[model samples]
Target chain A: MTATQPKPRTSRPGLLGIYRSDLGKKYAMAISGVFLLLFVFAHMVGNLHAFEGPEQINHYGEALRELGEPLLPRTMLLWVGLRIPLAIALAVHVHAAYALTLTNLRARSGSYDGRNYLAAGYASRTMRWTGVITLLFLAWHLADFTWGIKTVNPDYVRGDVYGNLIASLERWPVFALYLMAMGALGLHVWHGAWSLFQSLGINNPRFNAYRRIFAIVFATIVTGGFVTVPIAVQLGIIG
Target chain B: MNLTLRVWRQAGADAPGRFETYPAEGIPPEASFLEMLDIVNERLERNGAEPIAFDHDCREGICGSCGVMIDGVPHGPQLGTATCQLHMRRFDEGDTVVVEPWRAAGFPVVRDLMVDRSAFDRIIEAGGYISVSTGSAPDANEIPVPKDAADAAMDAAACIGCGACVAACPNSAAQLFTAAKLVHLNLLPQGQAERDRRTVAMVDTMESFFGSCTNHGECETACPKGISIDTIALMNRDYLKARLSDRRLLGRS
Candidate 1:
């Protein structure tokens, strides 16, 4: 018997490699999570302009569409170019999250008879449920504000950003749904923001405290900023 | 101490298992957890009942062979202690204790309180070594390693390959075990030649069988050696760099 010489071949992992491994999927989730976090912060700040006045908020909405105008075109450039990266990030984030969840379920053949959580945190345990809630909220948010769907908000007008927002939040049911969604968002952001750093391999004992603080601060600000608009509208403050 | 034990009983790997209650009376306080189990098995044998089977070796903590999930926490709730090191004194008289094997898809039950952990061996086999030609031992002073690096390497090297980290994890993730193996060698200059290749291959192998790490930090607590979770972060960093810059594919071009 004899052994044959093997042919030389490259062992490099290509772009698809990120999706092939759990660690790579985690890195993808972390990077996309950071991108989504920045977008959420920016979006919350823009929405807070409603507290100033209807005209200010309306102008803010228009400005978003008109960004990079002279160099590019209206809304065309914004949707086609500027928002492409965000859309890609969101798609990758959702895909990776779903894949990880499935893998986790398959890994556990059976659960403990009487389970006790010693080191697991509340946010970590509830991430999947909170993530689902946030996804549903995102779809409804796009319908009520961006697409001006009458089913979500009867008063939603194509160009009336401020009026549409106030009208939607004025209703008790819509406000309640928004509140619940914000609660879920708060939990998701809190866990996601703190853990993403570790997922990206930035774990250090010295910065753990700061990481917790950052997660809390970021979640509070984003959730608070968005929730304030609806509550103020209900109180006639925005009107 | 007279305690009630709810032990998981199974016939074989493919067989279904369940908790069977047994009264462990007259157990000594000084007896280790495994010793108490030995007493229970002796009683069962005298009664013509099947004796419970569990894994243990070296009776001391160094072997890493003994493991059981006691009351849902791996290694019986004693911090940084293996089952062999957990004395029966820790449990109160008449307490009800649940004893179970490591529950993970990657670790199928071989019998009562024992599961196949060869998945870990397979992962190590994937890339957990440096390619060195066997020869005479090098001089002690040949390689001058910094004290801190040597210390860190030793710290990561303390992992005993116990599967408690997997059993205790909510997702059954093995990131800590894989990370410990990677960090122990990757920190040493002797492992520099195949650092990138080792990282990529090992990580890929791990992902094939285990769950993803969500940073729950449960694994660290469950580890008998008190292996730090910092090794996980180091592994992640090395893996990312390897994915981007390893010379595996470039050789083709």
Candidate 2:
């Protein structure tokens, strides 16, 4: 756009270049991953209202519905500003994961017949599987709670967040599914939290320990907070 | 040490490869891995059989020419040791040792345990160097590199161009190798002029045939020189600066 600008050193095709290159795809994945991580953490903290009894939990749900009442409108800010952005983030994360999987496969022209791993942790290796399971769990979760699908949760009430949570986890099979999903989410976060820093080029040997501790603690807290409500309901502590 | 070798036998790049077992009996424990292979090849030739094909030079660990997946671990189970430095004593009697080439799209099998690692040369050629006037070695006093930068650069410079990092990575990523090469030069004052161009060009060349890094730490474990993964973070920083800065990488400006 300027006369003094230097010549194009790369044929890097703009935004499309991000998707075409290996590093750019990771940047997309890591950036989107950050939003998803924040969403899950905030979701868990909000859900902790269930411990304060039905009144607090239901009020928390209504607060979300009326996020920008006077300034904007009921649910306007929540849907347009938060939920829609989260959905896009999730979509981008999934897209990047799918593309990278193919690249990794092709790069490995073929593996050694006796190939074995030395330092790749189980959580790092099982990211794709855990990621898929997390997606499936998200669908079930939305149906049972957000969409109020009768078949997914017969006792789901539109605004009764506490009642819906209790009714859903009361079923043994549903409880099992939630627990399994939490395990998968924990593993995904463990690898992803640290990986995001590397993908973003914000790393050094000096702060590696802090990065590790953050990944473990974040994974633990997020998984623990979300699962606490269901376990409390099952134990009759919330009733 | 008496070892049973399950060595991959391939005639050429396009030839059908298979495991060809051979007994390496009465081998001295002190003999290097390549030396043991030498003994095996000598016996095979005496019996009118084709010797195993492999790459080796400067039996010392510095050359980086010799390497293989010894029992599934690149450069064998001995950590921070090259295949040339790995000794037969690392094995036991009657052990079944598996030897295979670095199997990656970027590194095709030439024959037997030998792989064509020319992909690495191409990556380096893309940028891994600084432009110089090619007269003679400049006086060390002319350029005063800070102690920290010099040490870090030396650490990166220890890379031997071995493909073990690629062979060990589950994704076959050359990020570690490329990072080391980039860091070795990018950290110096001499590399400032073309730093951004070198980073972008080398990284693009690397991704052409290799996979992306996922921070598995496998490459560091399999690396003979024990190069740290922090170099990768540095390369990432350099690349982002080049592509995201206001300076447009536009054509012929």
The estimated TM-scores of all candidates read: 0.94, 0.95
Model 1: per-residue lDDT, tens digit, B176-219?
99999999999988888889989887887776677889988889
Every candidate's TM-score, chain A alone = 0.92, 0.93
**A84-136: candidate 2 lDDT, tens digit per residue:** 99999999999999989898998887777777788899999999999999999
Give a tens-digit lDDT track for model 2, residues B132-193.
Answer: 75345666547889999999999999999888999999898999999999999999888887
lDDT for position B102 in model 2: 86
Candidates, DockQ: 0.42, 0.42
Number of the top candidate by lDDT?
2
Off by over 4 Å in 1: A1-12, B133-141, B249-253
Steric clashes per prediction: 0, 5
- Native A-B interface contacts kept, per candidate: 0.59, 0.58
Candidate 1: residue A117 lDDT (0-100): 74
How close is each model in CA RMSD to the real structure? 3.8, 4.5
Model 2 TM:
0.95
For candidate 1, the per-residue lDDT at A130 reads: 95
